[model samples]
Target: MTELEQDEYTSACEHALTNSMNEIKQRYLKLNTIFLVTLNAATSGKKLMALLLRRLQKIDSEFLSGLSGLVMF
Candidate 1:
């Protein structure tokens, strides 16, 4: 692809990643409230959300790094 297409791809990728992170953050906050209210009942869900958040973070980092490499060309 041309430089313009690459730039557009990078922007779109970053925007999508940001949206994903924001959604996850909102869900995590909601889960936190539920965990506080229900204690034991929400423990598993909270843990799963935490795990998912961490994995998404890792993926985000890897994705940004890969995109940066691409931009260097």
Candidate 2:
């Protein structure tokens, strides 16, 4: 391959690698957050569990509403 073609291939590979790394990082963070929340609720008792449930319900409702709005478009 010509030098320009080699350079373009290298650039594309780098971009894909960067995107993969970012996705991995985001997944790790989401898992870590869930783990920490579970641990906290386990140690803190029913109050924390209830609070988390309420927050989760609110988030779920909001997410559903957002999806409905998107579907309307």
Candidate 3:
């Protein structure tokens, strides 16, 4: 091939490789964002459950205390 043809071929290959790399990077970023959102949702769910459990425990304690007073009569 002529030197000019070979240079053009190399430039085209470089462009193709760069495009492929950018596509891969974008997919990775999208996946990372999805994973972070899922993790945050799970963490928030756990915190809410813990708060509910604490509230339930407090209610149970008060109910038991009131029952004991009734039994003393």
Candidate 4:
């Protein structure tokens, strides 16, 4: 490709990446807020806290794996 075309392609790719990162950040924040609320509500129950911890660990591993796959791509 020509220099101008290459630059344009790079710019587009960068913009798309930026948008995707922003979306991921927003989603992570929302999920974090929900988790915090749930944790607070479950503070009185040991069983509930353990369950939440397990679920969160599972979700964190899955999220990390998914991110790794994306990075590989």
The estimated TM-scores of all candidates read 0.53, 0.59, 0.57, 0.61
Residue 51 of model 1: what lDDT? 61
What TM-score quantifies how close candidate 3 is to the native fold?
A: 0.57
Candidate 2 runs further than 4 Å off: 44-73
lDDT (Cα atoms) of all candidates against the true structure: 0.64, 0.67, 0.62, 0.72
Rank the models by lDDT, top first. Answer: 4, 2, 1, 3
List residue ranges in candidate 1 displaced over 4 A: 40-73
Candidate 4 lowest-lDDT run of ten: 64-73
lDDT of 3 by residue, 26-73 (tens): 655655565555555666798765655565556556555644554553
Task: Provide backbone clash counts, one per model.
Answer: 0, 0, 0, 0
Q: Which TM-score value belongs to model 1?
A: 0.53
Q: Report the C-alpha lDDT of model 4 over 1-73, residue by residue, as the tens digit.
A: 9999999999998997786676567657755875896688686788777877776776666667656655764
What is the C-alpha lDDT profile of model 2 across 1-73, one tens digit per residue?
Answer: 9999999999997896676666556655655565568668977898887777666666556555645554553
Off by over 4 Å in 3: 44-73
Worst lDDT window (10 residues) for model 1? 34-43
Off by over 4 Å in 4: 44-73
Model 1 agreement with the true structure over 1-73: per-residue lDDT tens digits:
9999999999999997777666656656655654455554345687766766665566556656655555563
Best lDDT goes to which candidate? Answer: 4
Superior by lDDT: candidate 1 or candidate 2 = 2
Best by TM-score: 4
